[model samples]
Target: MTNEFVLEAITREFPESVLLSSEPYGMLTVEIKKDDIKKVIHYLKDSSLEINFLTDICGIHYPEHPAQEIGVVYHLHNMMTNFRIRLKAFMTREDTEIDSLTDLYAGANWMERETFDFYGIKFKGHPDLRPILNMEDLGYHPMLKEYKLEDGTRTDKNDAMFGR
Candidate 1:
């Protein structure tokens, strides 16, 4: 029922899948291999752990770490006990393909598309994997750290109104 108990259950089940485990702010978070993400999530949903709710699926950009430049975070919740845990899988920019969770969680369709639109992380097996927010021909992922944070050339808005 506790975070430690849930963590142990997962670790015991998939020792090799878990690369790292941590608890920050009392919430359990585990980093797993991208190849084993679907299997691990399936176990969490079907096993006694009962982490059936998919709260959110988002992408993260850590440009400094070349090996883990792009990461996907899956937030899962157990409605019965109100327990929550996070699963993360990271890959390099060149290798951004991840298994889609649409089969396991119907709601993952939109989330996966959004992650793809922003982080350029492709979701394999996604029914209609395309941009949910961004245009189809954007040509670049805006959420990546490689892009500039602000447009210095822009002078249309007032500095005071924009808090600049």
Candidate 2:
């Protein structure tokens, strides 16, 4: 069962999406254009793909990389085809807002909140996007490569740990 429908939906709905691959990974990912996420998720769920099983969602931080701050990752499973894939979306600390997929996958509820906890990324329409872990006032994302010191200083923790 080729998921051409999801591809069509994405192409028709989001011609601006940075297409990653075709067929196998056709509806796998959309590079997370940030804005069209809702549309893409909805299309995937409604199309033949029916990737409704939101396995998990997490965010990674790489301060040294070109895309610093946050990298949201989504793991989806297709029950019909028994296929799984990891979708990644990058967002900077300054621009931490992305479309929500809760409407398509209810499992995204806590996962989205979890991502918000560590990365400060905001998932719009997540019902209650509150901190599930860590202190509420902790605005600094601890997962990034540029973790700050306790004295409110922006120094690389890795360097300090290794005695740089």
| TM-score, per-candidate, Cα-based | 0.92, 0.73
Evaluate model 2: give its lDDT. Answer: 0.71
lDDT of each: 0.94, 0.71
Regions more than 4 Å wrong, model 1? 153-164
Off by over 4 Å in 2: 1-13, 19-30, 66-69, 148-164
Against the true structure, what is every candidate's RMSD? 2.0, 5.2
- Total clashes in model 2, counting residue pairs 3 or more apart in sequence or in different chains: 0
lDDT of 2 by residue, 79-128 (tens): 97876555667766678788878877777888988888877788887899
Best by lDDT: 1
Ten contiguous residues minimizing lDDT sum, candidate 1: 155-164
lDDT of 1 by residue, 1-164 (tens): 99889878888999999999999998899999999999999999999889999999999999999999999999999999999999999999899999999999999999999999999999999999989898899899899888677686988867789687
**Pairs clashing within candidate 1:** none
- Number of clashes recorded per candidate: 0, 0
Model 2 / residue 124 / CA error / Å: 1.2
